[model samples]
Target chain A: MTHTQQQNEHLWQLMFEKVAGVISTKDLHYLEAQLREDESMQEAFHAIQISFGHEDLERLKEDEDWIDILSVIKTRPRTTHQHRFGKYTVAAVLAGLLVSSAGLYFLTNRKTTPPLAAVTAGESPQAVVLQLADSKTVLLSDKTTNIRLGDVQLHNAADQLTFSSPDNFSVYGGQHTLIVPVAKSYRVTLSDGTAVWLNADTRLQFPFSFNGSSREITLLSGEAFIEVAPDAGQPFIVHTPNSTVQVLGTAFNINAYNPKQVRLSLVSGSVKMNTHGAAVVVKPGMEAVYTPPEGLYTQSFDEKTVLSWKAGKHFFDKASLSDICLILYRHMGIKAVIDSSLRRHDIHFNGMVDKHKPIQEFMDDVKNMTGVDYYFDAQGILHFR
Target chain B: MKRKVEQHNDKQLLRRLRTGDPNALNDAYRQYRVWLLVVATTYLTDEAEAKTLVEDFFIECWDKNLFKDVRVPLRTFLFKTLTERCKKQGIQINMYP
Candidate 1:
């Protein structure tokens, strides 16, 4: 390379390093001087900064189809992801970026990445299904499933469904529910960018996009950990049969599988839980248990134990036998019965349940560890004696 | 024939984008935003942060004209930019390495 080319490369490298937040102030002048004289240097510097955020950039870059994702969605306009600005404004900004000869070259010269192909039969698990507003049942059996509803798009990949939008489709708004069957869990990204990790037997109802002041969803049943997208103008609300939770923005978990006692655990941010017209606000690291007649109460909970399902594992500090059996039944479709002989065992045990393993294996491991002998009855009921 | 057609389409889109057409950029964003978020989340673990970072990257892409003389694909360029940025931030991408 020539001397000028070498100098420019060194300058680009320095500016790129600065994007990663590594350069000192002294190095700033050299970068600034180059950037001011050469517009491409500035563009390159900014591009590098935005692309390399931390470790995640590498994984995204390696994905060949990452660029064509928008192209695929263009075929179906309504399904949109997070769009803070309207299409025109977004385009104007992007146009400004592309106007730079350097930026234009960067965008066009590269090979066009292929769009994600539809999930074939063998690529996905067959258990989950999507019940659309039109009552059209779409089976999600592949590793990734993409469905288009008018202008709205739904992409389900690896147990997660992300709702996104197409450019021409202005406001793709509607209501939809995701039902996760027993012995399974799924994650979803709502139109507003709120992420919900739904546990087994969870039916979550949400809109295709938030049009109103409050973004509300019904947790018909089961457990979910929610990370609400921050929009002070809109409050994120979750409704259950017995309780309703309201928060501006935050990450929290709600276990409302039981109609009687609805558990709301906040990991960060604050949530206002209302049960039977009685309200209580829960702070970070705190939990609120709402029972209709008894009202809502607050207490500290083990974060690891409460959030362990995200890792496909369940942990208990001193969990009771009945409670554990109920949990197992709920998660593994196991019919666990405690024989009258062992009813009073009151087996309070500490253990971990690996959801990936077969229910029988977990049962045997627990039985041996607790010395609580168990056998399958004539009816296939697991009886603990 | 299909490859040539796609190449023609890509070139057309790039030409429009170079003339400061917002639709082209918007189209690109719509297509790749989620994938970018997915990649961001793998490292940040926080959806909000990942989204914000990706958005910032897009804006920068607009303002800096980082796409000049693009030899690599746009997606590859963005990925390359993201990795280099992360490296400077002292983030280790590969756990095994």
Candidate 2:
């Protein structure tokens, strides 16, 4: 590595060391110096501060925005994220069944590759779909799909969807919704240069270009991490079913899957979560939970463990058997049937598992770790004993 | 009014420094050495280079009266001046925190 790159890497190591309480006074002085002036260094330091220790992990679970920062750092370019799926990789036949009821027709891709076949109407539905302002739907099935509207260009390649617009690009109206299917994850960059990573079963509706005093987007369902581009004049607002997060140059995550509560985690900078008439400002390393009756409440969190899904990895922190089964069912397309008599639902497991691995391997690992046995029955349903 | 007070204090400090008073430089160093070191290290990322740059800044301050007629606060002046130097030296300086 070059000298500057080596120095940056060393600074990262020193930051971890300082957080671990092993750094010397000299290193601490240097670290403090770097943190004050370098924005990226400060970001790295905050990430380590909220992502390392057990208590910190709990804090991370509370303020889960660090996952977005890690994803941006580890995976650059933000497009075409390829996953090495195991031999038992299924194209989510469950999604086909779910979409079958929607009665939506599919259009074949003109530039379909032979290696990965185009999503047929009833066979394998496109995992990602874009709905335009004109009420026309576009299934992202081609390896690289480019859609141009006005000054903005939306490019969809593999796992990421990026948007690029000119400096003076602005829109007075028009909106689009990006939908991520079950067992799939996608990333997108907005016209304002804000980066958003959408989790499975999520629908995000955003304007073609922000023109009002405030930039606003609505999340119909599921979870998303948003890195708001710095624009002090116009604040970015994410409106969920239960709450709205008002952001000014910040990185945060919103989980709106549970109907009873909407979870908001701030990684860096600040955000205001408003539900009903009540509102609360969330700082870095903090989480704001908005439950109907209780209103809004804030607490510390563990960012790394909470946001691990952004990296296509699972970090279970005493996750209950039912919860793990549900996650597997949602993300892995694995139908888990835990025997009520044999399974202990209260028993929680703590470990990391690569989602790219086969369901059998995941079950085997879980069995080895929790001393629980699981097997696939004749009907392809996972049975736990 | 806040900006005026800041500028007034900066003018006083520079006036004292130009009089060749050792304590004036010491006072200035005491006030900004840590901050200056941080800004320098962020650019150089090396202790030796950081020290050299800071020393060069001070040496130039003594010779050229760098902040003699500055209207802004000394902190702002120092940061703006040093950041420009950093850019000329080909170091990437992040504008936002």
Candidate 3:
């Protein structure tokens, strides 16, 4: 091929990549620059665009206009129909109440509950513990059997607890707290059919059976990915330290490890987050962060990075040394102490730590990459120098 | 004759638009939205962002009272303004030959 022909082929390749939504930013800029200066290149790009225009038009037609353009320009109420949530009547009603009340229900439950001393760090339990409403605590492991509490039966199979309640109209049978200690994770299915995957060093409290207009659960601490069962009559509400997330029927991950902020990433469907007096609705692929003083705000998030813990891996993107140590302590139950000399310097890491792999593999990788040496002291604490 | 008739209608629409007539804005959107959207998507390669650009173009035209000083035909003016906006976003389309 001639040099010009080869350049044309390269330009066409870039155009195709652009249309496929996989063009790197640098190549896109180069292609745009060529299209700007060369009329023939402009014609070629337009031809490529027109070839896909019909399908693009069809897709655009099928998309519901979430914002009414004309009404917004006219300074009128841009009441676009929320067709996605139309089937959930109670969700629609609660959404309306959320707009009008500015989170009155959330504010009423703002009193902070004291942290459970039993699950505190440095004294972390080795196995999962379930505290029943009768103040009876049961240690859970792989060989545990079923436990009955009132009309509900906790079926223990391996690392998961599935609740089977025969009656649906039972009154509030009292709250049960599930504590997952460091170096472990557990899954629990609430009586309302909501499945919650508890992460390490996590605490979750839920009732035996939901009998009211809303199914309420408290994420006392740590992280959890919850898949809520669709119940139009009773909206599922999750209470964290700094905020409350109201879900009609959705799956989302809530990270409340930092006591100052609660990060809730919505996987599917919509959720309303209420913090202090501010309320924001979070859509799928978006995260709502609530911190005291800063309040609540929503931003786009990467799904693979935010929800990687469910797959038994923790991904770090330019995380500080101190942060990595905290994560190690949280996931591996090994107290990581950085030497004072190493702590003064700004050292960051980019890697993944697998829960299934031995901690030494990760330590070796870190040491090889950054020349940071680590050893377990006499007290079983990890020390980095 | 058909071209002249369109030019006359365009003048009337421009007059109403400059006077802040909502019907004129609605008529303009109904008449030109699809063509403008096609032009925008061709450059942006993102359907959502393209729709926003088109919508924002019309809204900004109204907000800035840009129709009052239109020396060219309304269609040409709209096309030229939208092309400039797309150019600002780093994609350039060939104007009328």
Best prediction by DockQ? 1
Q: Can you give the DockQ of every candidate in the order shown? A: 0.05, 0.01, 0.03
**Root-mean-square deviation of Cα positions for candidate 3 versus the true structure, in angstroms:** 24.8
Number of the top-ranking candidate, with lDDT as the measure: 3
Shift of residue B40 alpha carbon in model 2, Å: 63
Instruction: Arrange candidates by DockQ, descending.
Output: 1, 3, 2
Specify the CAPRI tier of model 2.
Answer: incorrect
lDDT of each: 0.62, 0.62, 0.68
Model 1, backbone clash pairs (residues 3+ apart or across chains), number: 36
lDDT of 3 at A40: 48
Per-residue C-alpha lDDT of model 2 across residues A270-343, encoded as one tens digit per residue: 99888999999899999999889878899997899668779877677788778787777656656677887784
Q: What local lDDT does model 2 show for residue B15?
A: 71
Q: Report fnat in order of the candidates.
A: 0.00, 0.00, 0.02
**TM per candidate, chain B:** 0.72, 0.72, 0.82
TM-score (chain B) for model 3?
Answer: 0.82
- Evaluate residue A344 in candidate 1 and report its C-alpha lDDT on the 0 to 100 scale: 55
- Residue A56 error, candidate 1, Å: 46
lDDT of 1 by residue, B1-97 (tens): 0111112234555666566555776655654565555444433433454555676566555554554445544554554565444333221222100
- Which ranges in model 2 have alpha carbons more than 4 Å from their true place? A1-126, A149-152, A164-173, A340-343, B1-97
True contacts kept of 2: 0.00
